[model samples]
Target chain A: MKRRDFLIGAAATGAFTAAPHIWRKDTSLARASNGEIKVGVLFSLTGTTGIIEESLNKATLLAIEEINDAGGINGMKIVPVVEDPASDPATFAVKARKLVVGDKCVSVFGSYTSASRKAVLPVFEKRDNLYWYPTLYEGRECSKNVIYTGAVPNQQQDEFIPWLVEKFGKKFYLIGSNYIYPKEENNYCKKLLEELGAEVVNEEYVPLGHSEFSSVINKIQSTQPNVIFSTVVGDSVVALHRQYRAAGLDPDKMPMASLTTSENEVAAMGGDAAAGHFTSAPYFMVHQSPENERFVEAYKSRWGGDKVTHFVSEPSYFQIYLFKQAVEQLAASDIDPTTIREAVKGQELIAPQGKVHLEAENLHTWLWPKIAMAKSDGQFEVLRDSKEWLKPEPYAAYPNQHCTADGLVQS
Target chain B: MEFFLQQIMTGLSIGSILLLIALGLAIIYGSMGVINMAHGEFVMLGAYGAWAMNAFFGVGLLPSLIVVFLGVGALGWLVERGVIRFLYRRTLDTILATWGLGVMLQQMIRLSAGGELRYVEMPSVLTGTVGILGVDVPGYRVFIFVFVAALFAVTWYLMFRTTFGTKLRAVVQDRSVASCFGIDADKVYSLTFAYGAGLAGLAGALVAPLKSVSPEMGTTYVVDAFFVVVLGGVQSLFGTVASALMLGELTGGLAYLWNDTIAKALVLLAIIVLIRFRPQGLFVSRIRS
Candidate 1:
């Protein structure tokens, strides 16, 4: 046989030998002798979303490195199997499958977008594995195999809308990227506005990666809304803010209040355009706490002094410790998806954002919400912070729908 | 009536940006029939060049445009000479190869600069607004309109009124015949490609302040630029301008009436219908061979 055929035969034989090890119901048994726990790190290192997701990847790695350096969890070093999904949802599913099935990671920590999370959901569910998601997203999902360590609508928008209405005015203009996250956010905003008898001047959605915002700015000018509630993400965030500034709209009169605008976007938008705009999030890099101080210091030292942390990266960093805490609660050999899921429940970490609890009932994190205004120096000034950790209510708008320990419950 | 003028002004500003992006593609694909898929990457390089000049050397955006143009234009020349030169006639292969080149450029930039958003500060002089017809228009946008017009005039002069223009057009029409006339078709094509790439770089530099400078930012511009170029007759420069303005006005008008998402859908539908009926596009060239 030729060399190609011979290599193919050898690969086939190697696969046949590795089959039993992979096919085992509990693949952890196969790696018992290694003294190292394998986990997967799935983040888009390249593509349209890579600009933001790259920071998330660095944060996840920084956490993993810190854990390994600190003697690790029960003497087993976490070996992260890093994979780049390249910002595509289909690729996210493929990489997720590789992490759960091929590498047999005890758990996978990844995904910044709702689309990516939804894509990887089936992979974790089918294999009965755990996946830790770290990003503030549109709520309404309750997956047993996924630990949501990000803020939902209640954690972000619940007190935010009332505060905005009180501070700004009754008239609001809603603008967002044409995606599920923004659409759902607008839905929740509308629901809250209806409750408060606030008027929605107009609502508009732009396609993702849309850079031109002249027309949209015109609409905002014409409408003359007191506050602009925006859910625009990615490159569009920078474009919208700059164009809004260019159109001579004063943020003091009608600031663009957003759930998506973070330090990362502000850095891109420049201080002039982003100044006076407000962002509602669970965490800002400038949050005053010992944990945050250490986190910012460490992240800067590790990634470089210029590297900035945002709301999502904070969760990406802390969720690893939550995992370590969860795993340490159980014996080495006794660890698996079901046991770890139970242990990870109710696990609380003093994250940079502050004391956060992984909700026992729904596998979602309870985070401290805060409202901040972007300063001209590319940082946020915290205006209001929740006095306590807000519980994660995944289905806040749909009053009849609830995510319980058993699963989603609908009346 | 004021709102209508404001809408029209906004449309014109949007159209100016579209023209900035499409002018380069029109020069390359329109004249040469070579599908320059890496054109967007050329734009991306220009943005990065602006950022680098600002970050490392303290060169302002306006001052850095000349350097960015030459730098990106030189790289375009290298690409045309090394790879695109050999595959000039093979349209399908050029598309695939250039697309691969675009991807390579993106990855290369990501590795070098790190995949984070970079900001370009707008000139202080251009930060204010200009009032026209009782509407306050952004000074930077007004500058763009004037700059695009000047660039278009220069490009037009080069294509129609210069010796290089005659030679380039002759080479494009019949490479063999141009070679027989001692025009050096290879030289004309390479310079044409470089100039087109340079125009794209100029567009990118001008836009860097308005949009975030990132590796993938070019992808956003490229798609819209293609729409403008195709909807305008691929061979006609005036057609590109007309289509860009028309699309801009349509989008602005429709978006004002309804929403952005619907406006984009309708504009796209209109383009599709127009393309189906008139494949040669809105303007048909009457030049005889």
Candidate 2:
């Protein structure tokens, strides 16, 4: 009788521990005569990534407000359930699971880092929901469950590297924070640089959250590479920029270019420090267009004039409006995850950067990359703009991506 | 030769900061027989204090060091008296309790101050470079080196030449006998702990301009400080200094040759191998049993 009681107790404990998993499998997210279309908004609103992601979160809200003001999506109010990942990858996955399984969000949108996106991808894919990742990243890899709204290497590096090689004598010195994105981007750039007969003098990566760059600075002074390609991110950006200037290296003579530097960083590092540096992105605050002007005005008016927007901020704002258009065009009364995902494909919106479209082959957008030079006032002056919207290359190969990628002509 | 010189300079500058961080632990743990795992959180509080003074009161980093020391030091005194006083003589319990206190303090800071990185501007006078022997060394780095030297002197004098230090040493060696001699062992212990905490705050204040101040910043420093303390013979102040210098140089020298990740790994491995040989650390205190 005691043995039987022990077995019963063990079984009860097992059942209790497994309860959360059992609760996670429920997929009753489809709207039935919708009172409100619920969407999950996830962002690192606090922690190390907070300063950068804070603006993006506000941008998401601004877009949602604009949509809700315009008679709501599908004549139903769009309700948002926001969750903070606190800049932790593990926490991002946990909050993502809660957003999808518990909150029953129709679609989840957010993730500033590639690491966080990778963490949350499996959850979204398993749960059969769309994840709109808005951060620009190194090229390659795609998922049906996720949309690549950010600029890829082909759109960003490919355009900028050639321009740099032609303009500056290319004894390239590379530096980045030790992360997958920087490593991958630098490798891709090196491959491209070698193809054009440019020499990569040295490459180095300091750890993320790294404060000091004195050793790297000394090395740079000695080597004196013609072009410096950097991919440093986060709080480290502020330190590196200030230290570089204090070291007395002329930015114009050996100007640095980054895939990650944006208006937000420039402002944070304080104005005039980032002058003469170049950054390539799909959008900048000083973009010349009626759409950009109106978007910038709306952003400043809503968030206050002092709050500056950047590359990731614009994509996040546009993605909400894009999602709304996709859902409204579905023409299905029961707007579930499936209908929303399908409707989003092959949809085009004149974003703040200009016209962006979701080409059906891979769930990536066609974005126009611009190379801008940082001015003293914490703003970018557009140096060069692309001829048209450049399609993303998630799996763009060594050299023949422009000539022959499978999904090139599908649009 | 120039590159080697540069690497050594980098090491020394880095090592000085490590020494500042580890000194507090060495004193408190060495004298009080209590391991304060909340040492890093105390450093974080110091950084926050400096940042607050700079942002709100417009006090410069140089002027705010004293305030940071007193503010964070008072808190540390309270923590030692309130929570740590009971856990004396129980090493395991002290470690556990202090670690728990560290987590609670981290969460409290995160809740109240928010987890975003706070900026502390470097004074314009010290932001430029000073040319030394045909190399441009940052003025701030030079200032830090000088400041660390000054701090080392001050602390050494306090520990070796002062009456409080004699009393603390007496209490640490023989608490019952020191009490019999009318030395108030408890008061000495409390004061020693607060001084250690104040030293940690001074370290943080000095570092505020160089790095982005955040709640989690102390975690990294404390781990490095532990290494310095452990590898230097935790009871010997001079040993802590030597270990910190050696470790920082190894890291900087390796970083010149390899990536920061591999360099850090190599330095850590080197420390482990060294500790394997000398488990009691490089130097041990001589005490009559």
TM-score of each: 0.92, 0.89
DockQ-derived CAPRI band for the predicted complex in model 1:
medium
**Local accuracy of candidate 2 as per-residue lDDT tens digits, B107-225:** 89888887766667777898888877766778888888888788878878888899988888888888899999999987888888998999888888877777667788888888888
Please list the Cα RMSD from the true structure of every candidate, rounded to 1 decimal place.
5.6, 6.0
Q: Which one wins on TM-score?
A: 1
Q: Write model 1 residue lDDT over A48-131, tens digit each, in one string.
A: 787688889899999999999999889989899999999999999999999888987999999998989999999999999999
Model 2 over residues A232-342: C-alpha lDDT tens digits?
988787778877876777887888899898987786566556899999999999998998899899999999988777899999989998898888876545576777778
Q: How accurate is candidate 2 locally (lDDT)?
A: 0.83
Chain A TM-score per model, please list them: 0.93, 0.89
After TM-score superposition, what is the CA distance of residue B238 in candidate 1 from its true location, in Å? 1.9
Clash pairs detected, candidate 2: A140-A394
Reported per model, the fraction of native interface contacts reproduced equals 0.74, 0.53
Error of 1 at A170 (Å): 1.0
Candidate 1, overall lDDT? 0.91
